[model samples]
Target: MARSQIQDVIRCQYCENEPAVFHCVPCGDELCPRCKVFHLKSKVPSGHNIVRLSERLHPANQIKMCEVHSSKAYEICCKVCQVPVCIMCIQEVHSEHAIGKIQDLYEKLKAETIEELTTIKTQLKSEISQRIKDYIMGEKGIKTSHEDIREKMKKQAQIFINDISAILAEALQESEKDERKYIVEIARHTAEAENFEQTLDQMIEKWETLTDSTHPVELILYRKQNPDIFKLLKLPNKLSIVMPSFSVGQINKSQNKHQFGKLITSKVNLIKSPVESSKHIQPTMSAKGNKSKKRVLERSVKTSQIKAEKRKLCYMACRDDRSAYISGDGPGIQLIDRSGTELDNISTDGEPIGLAVMLDRSLIYSEYDNKVIYKVALNKQKTEIISTEHNPGGLCCTKSGDILVCMGYRGTARVVRYNSTGRKIQEIQTDQNGERHFSDPFFICENVNKDICVSEWNFLKSKLVVLNKSGNLHFTYDGHVIASILKDRFQPSGVATDSLGHILIADRANNAVHLISQDGDFLSYILTENDGISRPYGISVDRHDNLWLVEQEKACVKVYRYL
Candidate 1:
């Protein structure tokens, strides 16, 4: 047998040879059959509490004897000294100091410490991980931008090869030199960020292990030794990469090759970074001195509203650029800036139903009319990626670059998971009882917890269905009972999730947005017509947790800060 396969044996405290089968709680000693008799007759009293070794209480929960008065267990907590004391010690040293029950103080401190640790862990998992992803994605974007500049240069060079071949060589060389320099710097920064991400991962693992521990003394000692462990870690500054630009001059054969366009080097700009998120976060505690309740989603403040060019906003996908791709009745998807100015337009085969942006900055759209899914490259080239049997309505790109598509034919609806190459991996349609869970999954998005949330609607009824990563039904939501009073039938449209794993569903009929917990319990009404939201169709939560919602009636996308 392997060493790891061997079970540890607990020897008797007194005999050391025999395995301990009994435990004296008050004496904090374990004894075998022979030692138990001797232990009972010796120092330990016969009336002392004895239990089976298997029933031994965790040492952390065990009553600690006071150092000054060993006969009495700690009963009072001195607020001035922040220490536990016995009745005798309180009378001698803590008589004038404020005090409370030691057990009550311990519970409060533990709750506060655990809440802080949880906050740190949440930041490490969401913020740090997102920063790492951003770093990597920025590298890819830089490379893509570089390739695009080079491709343009190649085309320009092909036109005037005879006149400026030598100068073209120098320009190309200079571009390569700049690329090498910037790529190296980016690689170094990426490595540093990755190392920090790893450290945060280790810290999260340590927190998990510590929180799992049942020993109170160890937890208290750990907190004392590492006072800052519960606090949020300071992450590195956010750096923005500026894409290099090339100024192309008029192609004049008479002009010298030196007059050719020059390659401007890319720049790395440091932006004023916000820690974790925009909102100031503190350790949440319950007023009733209980475990912290689940975070509540409150009505958001409408910050900006941009009028989209499209008449009816079908879908909206956002990028790190603060720009969004809006698709509607037209056969083209328009990329619009934060101010709603159209920057570029990519033509599609048909009206794009589902639009999503991948980590590589590529765009994916599913066309219901063509029954096909297409990928638009960074160079504006569109190619058919997947041919679906059923019409594809909504789609999203996962963290792993996989695509989740919502497909429906007639009345049957299902969600299919596919790799970037269009290889089908899994399908979510039926439950354990073989009953269909969706009639028409119109919009789909994945939560930070990897739960796949889909808003399914048809003429009969509508609901929000969430499934685990493994395709098992996690939960389902049909509108809040009280909110249903405004409308008889639930009509769920677009769906999005925030870092906190709260699901935001667009209720088109009610002209509101419903916020629910990860487990499908309704938390609150995030937005309603009273907030000037009309026919909210599509919704998305950006990295900053700001909600980007599309109002069909208004023909605009609204940004809100709800956190």
Candidate 2:
């Protein structure tokens, strides 16, 4: 037989009574349903495990109830010791004590506990509602993300099918043309053979009839006339049909196909979706174990740092905040509060060119002449030095606190990363194909997704270069028309991004600031005034998303608030 499950009984912490029904108020002692008793000194009456004598009694006013106690009325709690006592006990034990009514103390304690319980219940309800709202939002986000991916996949599949069908149709037409050409050539050759055979038969009959002296000469003349006839009749055993050899060059013209050189030069080649090499091809393993191991170490260090500083303040108002720092060519980085007050200014060894803030609240500023980054602390102290290869033009800090500096001159541009200790960790001066990155990288900023964006100025083109985290070229955007409309002097000088991932570029020559999307799409202009900005060199957006522009020639920093 199976054993029946037993239910556990709930009990008060202070009492050891079984099947506890009543809860104590003073020290939360539990009592059996029948043994429960309530002291008159207790605060809470109902909803408590301890039962009052009045609730168990039959008549409400049968016993002469005291006005002070309400149930068993008492004149005073105590005179000297402030302890609850009957009139007789108070006169003997606490005669000289200042007496107080028991009812007043009981009412005060009851009110306080009721207030506390009400506050606790309100807090619990609020927390539960907030959690429910968060769950709903999370579920909505997941659904939207799934729908977006599905739509993208559907469109991508349609494009692939269209491209494939076009390529296959062209191939089929070429194959059919080659087949028809071979068929026509075979028919023409057969007709030529029949004519040659008929001519030979007529010549043989004439030779059999004429056996005279003139017959030999006639035969010789006929043979000379048709000297090439026999040679033509004995057509080569296998005629060269000249069937069209599929060039395979058409495959190269298709954009979807990979480079032919890469395919042919590779050790392993694929034919009709299968390997068809005569020699056994061993798997080629990479020899970059050391490099990969270093990358893993760097990533681990970055992850640990992120975990340490887990305090995430998503919203910060920069208008009246002193934490926002800006750098210009004046002297050094100007430390200002949210109210735009200059708290303190730190001087650099060389002219200030760029500024970036690290995770530890330390400021990194690049000097133009010295080509070095000076680390400044909050105490107005210079700490470390970061050396760069070229004249540092721009500075930005990544999410992992890595510093990215833009350096370039003439026809070369690069974005290099450095660790917090002023050591160069990585450099990206060229594209994946080993081509020079850009003409001149004037400004650089890291996006939320870790991609580096550069404002480049070439002799003929002024554009922005977007590169992935691995330094691969992603896209380029040319502001040709906008530059021309602004009087052909739209050189991008300073670049910065907001929390929303919107990029703002200061067009120094054009005297305006252009706003661009995270994907290099031109959104609009932050500054539409023609002559409002004067040689803007440094640009920054504070925590409040207010635009700060450093006008180099004007020798003034302009602040614009978002309306």
Candidate 3:
């Protein structure tokens, strides 16, 4: 029924030059002999329901369409065959078929269609009602979950306040005990001084009387009684006391702020407490609640918190699986073994952000102040590499011995690769739409499959962007969520890769390191805060696959068995 068929004289759809000898109903196409064979052989199967126009010449059905030759008009019918026919079909295709007018069967067909609609309507009504019931149940479940979460958070806040109050009470108790001892010592010294003062006053009075009376007997008596008293007065004061004072410090300020209590005195001013938490009238945990709670209170307290080996390690790069070079909270980059033993140190001019290894196995490290990525010789010599147009953040060495540098300025970012000789090989910047991908890209590394992975953080989110060897995008990975700290998002600072293609990223906010697959899927995490990891900054894997963590606040590097 297309208007094009009227003006175009019904040409074959397959072979446009030839008049269509037949129209195929199922295909909605007109075809000549050659194209019809191609369609019948390859395009149509026994499955296609088609009508030839010559066979559909009855008036009622003809206006609709032919079963095979679907578009042309059929003007004749063979009464003996009871079938419709066109000129070519009557002669070559359906010469022996009986034909009839389709107008004669229209009323019966229309009646059948109306009857079928009733059955479809009844079936559709039941499905719609069931779907509506499911939607209502789903809505109720969502609201119930929201209500449960809101109530739980409120309870947690109250529990947190109780913990803080307990710490304050305990710290105050320590000061009180010290004050009581000071008061007792003061009272004892005051009583002894009064007795000495009394004896001296009496002796002086008796001496005055004896001198005025000129009596040798009276003077001798006073001298004999006061001689021992004078000796006692001349002796050093054993009860001398310095004033009582109390000192306090933030307990693990960089770690858990919730549990804090420091008892400071002159003899032990900066000593850490033996107890991990303060004594409190704690609420008895419900048997049901104990199974799921993972807050700091629920976790077991370690006896000795692991501190750093030496100065703070803010940045780290692996020399091998056993040792790494670190920089932070100190001037020089110190090489330390897996056990945190200092092996070597290379002095740097400023605070460093990241480090990498070059093809020559010489160390390359980036500092916060400079545009150039500096290289330190194994012999402790220093030299400047190429200067970037922007401040460099992360340096990662590719297997080809080339270096990939993260560069950015004015809140924009890109990655540039350079050969060992300071020649820029390629730059990977914007996406296909020409928008920069990073807010503040910090550390980067390469996966075993040659995918360059970059860790980036801004106020909004901390995420990783991975690119293939040719700088094409692979996927982005955001850090995993911690149920204990639901309000705070994960932020990555340090990045590293293990031999098994697992990526490790250090998070300062959560005090944990996130482990992810090489293809950017989140795997699991190493929770350090529970084990007393404070402000974990720099991260690296040693040759034995032990994880080296820089405890920033404690100014030390701690190692762990991660493999």
Quick one: best lDDT, which candidate?
1
lDDT of 3 at 70: 60
Model 2: lDDT equals 0.61
User: What C-alpha lDDT, on a 0 to 100 scale, does residue 472 get in candidate 3?
Assistant: 79
In model 1, how many backbone clashes occur? Answer: 1
Query: Using alpha carbons, what is the TM-score of model 1?
Result: 0.48
The C-alpha local distance difference test score for the whole of candidate 1 amounts to 0.81
On residues 1-563, what C-alpha lDDT tens digit does candidate 2 reach at each position? 12332245654343454566554433345555444543323565222334432343333212333443455434346534545566555443356677786656656656766765565467645756886897788778777776876686677768878888998899999899878887898888788887767877886777676455465777778787877864565643447755466665544356544322112221323323123321122122243322232211111110000010111111111222234455543455456653445656666666566667776566777776777778876455786577777888777778787888888786546778887787888888877577987767867888767778888887777877888899888778766446443765557877777666777787767777777777878867657445355666666666545666666655555566532
Q: Give per-residue CA lDDT, model 1, range 211-324, as digits (tens).
A: 896577777888899998647576766779988879997756455445556778777788755644523233343332221332444557877789876778868888753678
TM-scores, all candidates, are 0.48, 0.46, 0.44
Predicted structure with the largest TM-score when compared to the true one: 1
- Candidate 1 stretches with Cα past 4 Å from truth are 1-298, 483-485
Error of 1 at 272 (Å): 27
Which scores greater on lDDT, model 1 or model 3? 1
**Cα lDDT for residue 255, candidate 2:** 52
Model 3 scores a C-alpha lDDT of 0.69
The TM-score measured for candidate 3 stands at: 0.44
